[model samples]
Target: MKAPQGVTLVDHPLVQHKLTRLRDRNTSTKTFRELVREIATLLCYEVTRDLALTQREVETPLEVTTAPEIAGKKLVFASILRAGEGMLEGMLNLVPSARVAHVGLYRDPQTRAAVEYYFKVSESLAERQVIVIDPMLATGVSARAALERLKEAGARDLRFVCILAAPEGIEALRGDHPDVPIWCAGIDRGLDDHGYIVPGLGDAGDRLYGTR
Candidate 1:
């Protein structure tokens, strides 16, 4: 099904291979972390395709030449806490110069509602491209809430990147943020009874942090 809004489910083979490893229950924590990093790296590659760039004239060893480079302005990474932290290193590896901010949210089990706990954004959010990172998009409530907070903090140009997502969550994001394109490695079938993605890598936070 075509997403009505700005959402992309990356179907690359390498992403699939890594996702498979991430799904296995027997995979060790170290391996899962490594795979998450690898997958995040691949996802970041696509997510930053439209990053702002500026042209600069550089003098080569022999002569001066005009070339394009990332503008003096840096990017801001807004990582949804806990699970999102796992992907931070991967994104940073790709864009080490980028600034990072952390947003903490937790779901209320009784109401299944998101509650914000922490937030810290860079000073100049409006000038930088913002990439919101989270490994799973089960319900998108947390992601949506985080995005709203960022926008309130003056973040405008934004993109969201995730390793795995459910159809419903993707739709929710699209419905709320049609202009902000979402990049996901895979879009899983549906959510389980408890709001987890079906056949999805179970509990990304637990898998990454062993804190179920």
Candidate 2:
């Protein structure tokens, strides 16, 4: 499916192929972890595609040359914890120098609302772009809460990245943070009765960690 404005569907052939394996219920923990990392790397490539670059003079073995280099402060990857960590290493592989911020939120069983327990971010977030990551955009409560907290901590330029998203979650996130662009590998059907992404990879955190 084509992504609407403010959202990017990373539909590259490689991402699609990996995503299929990722969705297979029979995929093992080791393989699932591997696929997540691989797809995360591919998704990171798309997210950083339009980064600003500055030309610099370089002296080659033969002659002087000009090379384009990424300019400005390092980027921030704010992982929404537990499942978000699955994608972190792959993103770090792409930008080893990028600063990492961890934001923790848990949903109340009864309320189904996000509760923030810990929040920490790098200095000068307003000066750098931030990419917030989570494996599933189920209810968007955690994502929305994280965005609010990030904004409060001075994140002006931000984007959201996920492996799968439900239509309800996407709408909720878009309504809350329209300025923050979203990138996802897949957008499945709407949320089910329990607010889980229907036809989605089951319980990403559990699948990633081999936890029930």
Candidate 3:
């Protein structure tokens, strides 16, 4: 399927391999959690590929030279609660100095609407780039709500990253926030009746924590 205009599919071989294992029903919680982290790290590399850089003078063993370094304020990772938290560690492993924001939102089983219970973020969100992380984008309700809240909180440059996504979810997000880019390991077929991505790695929050 053709990805939306602002969507980026990270189809790296390693990422695809890990995602396959992650989708296995027999995979244990421990292994599932590890794969999520590994994939998050790989996706992070793609999402931040265009981050601004500046030249800085550095002294090497042989001589002094100019080197490129990340410029401007540190980036922020906004995890959309429980499932999003599963991707946090791997993202942090890549950008240890990056700031973190948590937007606690849960989907109502019956309505599939998003309910926000918590929100906390670093200062000067407008001055930094924010990447919202969530493992699955099945309905896109929670993601859209989280992004809306972040925008109201002063986040200007924003992006969304996920391990898997549905076409419906991608379209919904782009329709609401066309300027914000999306990066994911893969885009699944579509959502099922209960608002779950078909053949999705089954409830990510459950598998990650052994809650199910």
The local distance difference test score of model 1 is: 0.89
Worst 10 residues of 3 by lDDT: 1-10
- Measured by lDDT, the strongest candidate is 3
Return the lDDT, model 2, position 158. 93
Instruction: Look at candidate 3 and tell me the lDDT of residue 99.
Output: 100
Among these predicted structures, which one has the highest TM-score? 3
lDDT of 2: 0.93
| Candidate 1 similarity to native, TM-score | 0.95
State every prediction's TM-score relative to the real structure: 0.95, 0.98, 0.98
Ranking by TM-score: 3, 2, 1
Candidate 1, residues 74-117, lDDT tens digits: the string is: 88889999899999999999989899999999988888888999
Tens-digit lDDT track of model 3 for 89-166: 999999999999999999999888999999999999999999999999888999999999999999999999999999
The lDDT per prediction is: 0.89, 0.93, 0.95
Which regions of candidate 2 fall more than 4 Å away from where they truly are? none
Candidate that beats the other on lDDT, 2 or 3, i.e. the better one: 3
Residue pairs whose backbone atoms clash in candidate 1: none
Kindly report which residue pairs in candidate 3 clash with one another. none
Better of 1 and 3 by TM-score: 3
RMSD versus native structure for model 2: 0.9
lDDT of 2 by residue, 84-200 (tens): 999999999999999999999988879999998888899999999999999899899999999999999999999999999887788899999999889999999788878888788
